[model samples]
Target: MSAALRPFDVAAIRAEFPILQQQLEGKPLVYLDNAATTQKPMAVIQAITDYYSQCNANVHRGAHQLADEATRRFELSRDKVASFIQAYDRCEVIWTSGTTEAINIVANGIAQRLKPGDEVLVTEMEHHANLVTWQQACLRSGASLKIVPIHDNGALDTEAFAALLSANTRLVALPHVSNALGTVNPIQDLTRLAKAHGALVLIDGAQGIAHGGVNVREIGCDFYAFSGHKVFGPTGVGVLWGKAEVLQDWPVWQTGGEMIAQVTYHSATWGELPNRLEAGTPNIAGVIGLAAAIDWLTQFDVSAIQAHERALLAYATTLATDFEGIQLVGTAADKIGVFSFVLQGSHPADVGFLLDKQGIAIRTGSHCAQPLMQRLGLPGTARASFSVYNTLEEVDALFRALKKTQRMLA
Candidate 1:
């Protein structure tokens, strides 16, 4: 937490998002599906509107005044993103559609370098975005895929991870925080262990960045990926931060006008660090809006927000435990604001449907983690994910809704 930051005020924060004030089914909306995407604050929304209304132009290609202003704001957003994650060089941050595309960019680049018998390591708890990309990469290159196991408590098995690394391990990809279970992985330790074996590390930070500070240098991972929508920014924008030297040598997977330096009818040379990987026009307004979101977040102490969320999770957990037949999933000692659980003799989708009648929104189904669900021996769990703007009253409302749902089902 910064000393200069103002103390967090939940009420004030809630007021900044107009969408939260809406009514659903004649009841106030209680949005708990934050893991899927966070609602944008007015600052972020206005940033997008202002971009199109005031300075609508393509970046880095036109010589007009609007183009110049648009380009300046777009690149400034890049600088803000670089600073947000504490990257060593601003040029190391490459824009992508989201975490999914960012992971694919690295996976594809690494696939070109992979040889037969080289191993790509992942974990049993990874989101499909992190897991499937490496799986496909391994298939393309004839390299084997290795998985580190997780304990019954939803925590990564450190002993198992240590044993998996070896001379043939070329890369180790894992999530900083599990989206389904909310387990905060020991990324620093994992990165050190993998690096000791000369394996490149990529940290999927989609859930981690939303919780609090993330310093890539301290973690010492080769690459970090996250999405803007998960971090109070606009959708269709994301960032991939890599070591400058590592990205410099990475093969370009996308090619078009912006990525090229010199081109003829025969062949072409690629551009520098960031642009080489980012081909064609990007989501210009979304990038600007993401910078606004970052700027808005800087006003409050992130530590305060994290503490509030921890309290909410604890409160919600206690309430759920008292409810008959409500079984909590992911009991890791360290977790974030996610609460995943199952109701005995009830389907997760049915529970979600009942909650929706009370104007409560949550996520159900596999959560893009079917393998994780299979590992836990369940179909899926209804997930209620919290954010900075949520309140304790809302937490209580969730349980009340659950009680009503339980009686109706009975």
Candidate 2:
């Protein structure tokens, strides 16, 4: 189906998340820490409950009715994920513990192929999940880890990225959206440039998938990785989508049951495409819940969700600009619902604590992008990230709490 935007019903949407009805510290809870992880909708929670209640069994191993049912549901989630990302083939989708493990799987496989002095490129805006794995891979192979700089405006320096790419560049790891800055990188353009230099590209879609759906074929990247928890799904479940041709030759990273074709005393043969990568007992219930989340999300037009989030971010940004001693950290022309900022003469942790007293939940500190923090020359920033269920009223409440926090600190 073609993607289109529809009018959003915020109240109805908010009702789907049960956690939103609660209170914190005797005040109504105002959740704005979505960039860390989104609250699960009832649909997702119920799916998990149903799995544990009705069909809890080890998948793909038994002939019992419950095992058959469990296996069926587990594989069904893979099909749903493949469709969600518009992957070329369903077999291209490999399940992992989350984005961190997903990236590690690729890095482990790529480690076998890297050579001394080979260049692995990454942007400065990457989260630790994407950056650390590549650093380890380069270190193991005696390869060089090259960095692409970000502009002062929180956008990637595309010109610097272009200049950095060369025949020696083996892989380019980047994020679809900056988790800390909320800057949306031009993935398609970046992928094309990397591919032109004969480098494979891996996009960390942990933030991007929640904002809107992704189409891997259109982006032209070799691999895409995302976490389920970031998109209103259960934690400990994520996807790694790769081109079949490329994955076919990649060496297996993990070993054990469900990933071997033949076992012997001395050596064993690995299974095909996805099975080769996914080893041992999987997160069956989490995968099922993730599918439910994706199913619920598809009921609404993704473009509509994106627009709503953008509106919330713009509203928050405007309000922050008017506040005294407030400095917005990332002001990229393109961004999502993440508002990272710092107040003069106040520590980020103190601000977070003060906000929490009023039942406002926001993230503080480096947000796992310490390298990006070092580049920006700040200890940390207080972050308020929005989602589809967030409202203008919540944004207003956030500012009110911030005002109170500023006064207390002053």
Clash count list over all predictions: 0, 0
Instruction: State TM-scores per candidate.
Output: 0.99, 0.98
> Per-residue CA lDDT of candidate 1, range 1-410, in tens?
56779779988899999999999989989999999999999999999999999999999998899999999999999999999889999999999999999999999899999999899999999899999999999999999999899999899999999999999999999999998999999999999999999999999999998987899999999999999999999999999999999998799979897998999999999999889999999999989999999998878777787899999999999897678899999989999979999988889999999999999999998899989999999999999999999999999999999999888888
Model 1 misplaced stretches (Cα beyond 4 Å): 1-3
Model 1: lowest-lDDT 10 consecutive positions: 1-10
lDDT of 1 at 195: 97
Off by over 4 Å in 2: 1-7
Q: Which lDDT tens digits does candidate 2 get at residues 163-245? A: 99999999999999999999999999999999999999999999999987699999999999999999999999999999999
Which pairs clash in the backbone of model 2?
Answer: none
Give the number of colliding residue pairs in candidate 2.
0
- Give the best candidate by TM-score: 1
| Candidate 2 lDDT score relative to the true structure | 0.93
